[model samples]
Target: MTASTLSAHHVGITVNDLEELLAFYRDVLGLTVVDRFAVGGDAFADAVGVEEGRAEFAHLEAGGIRIELVEYDPEARGSPAAGLNQPGATHVGLAVDDLEAFYADLPESVSTISEPRTTESGTSILFLRDPESNLIEVLES
Candidate 1:
């Protein structure tokens, strides 16, 4: 296998609140909802290693990148841990045309890690948590 032969399919994020997270990604971030669906049954349970796997899901696309948001059944769900230093913790980085406008447009309820800052390389980046507390990094393209 080679890197050239591989391409990104999508980033899967597990959320507790489907509607809230969907609103943030779709309405707030302006990502287009490509598709929405629900999954369940014995097959899904076996694949996910859950006794009875079931969930609602949505796929949003932005700049050719797809974000798969999943809201698992409450009975089969676990709480999210905090901190980026933890193992297996993942954050999605997105490139935006206007960093300032993007930051300003974010709702006040959105918890930002800090104000947008430019690095020595001249790339502007900011960090914020989604409705489900998933860390998202927005960078100026």
Candidate 2:
């Protein structure tokens, strides 16, 4: 039987620094912080596939899509080794009104993977990384 009625609720990202990540999403990206809370326990650990899990979480919303940021205890955290060609690597793409202006306003701390470039199809895209090195793409709509 085929499962139906499935939809994305939010994208969860495990972060090393909660405040820094929150500032990037909320202040820099203009997402609204919906809520913040702490979570831990055997149930959560099992669900996350961690032997023991504990974290501070925040929910931010942008253009109706929600992003859940989780900052696990230092001992529980793992190193990030995701590369562009890696199987499990993931990136979020956002549509912007002014790609050039937005690119110009980006903080100096952001490492740009690619400057804004336009394709033959008239779509402009910019690729960059967050402080934690999460890849992000901004496209002109």
**How many residue pairs clash in model 1?**
0
Consecutive 10-residue window with the lowest summed lDDT within model 1: 74-83
Error of 1 at 56 (Å): 0.9
Off by over 4 Å in 2: 2-4, 74-80
Provide TM-scores for the models. Answer: 0.89, 0.88
- Each model's C-alpha lDDT? 0.88, 0.86
Clashes of 2: 0
Residue 83, candidate 2: Cα error in Å is 2.8
Alpha-carbon RMSD, each predicted model: 2.3, 1.9
| Worst window of 10 by summed lDDT in candidate 2 | 73-82
**Residue 54 local lDDT, model 1:** 91
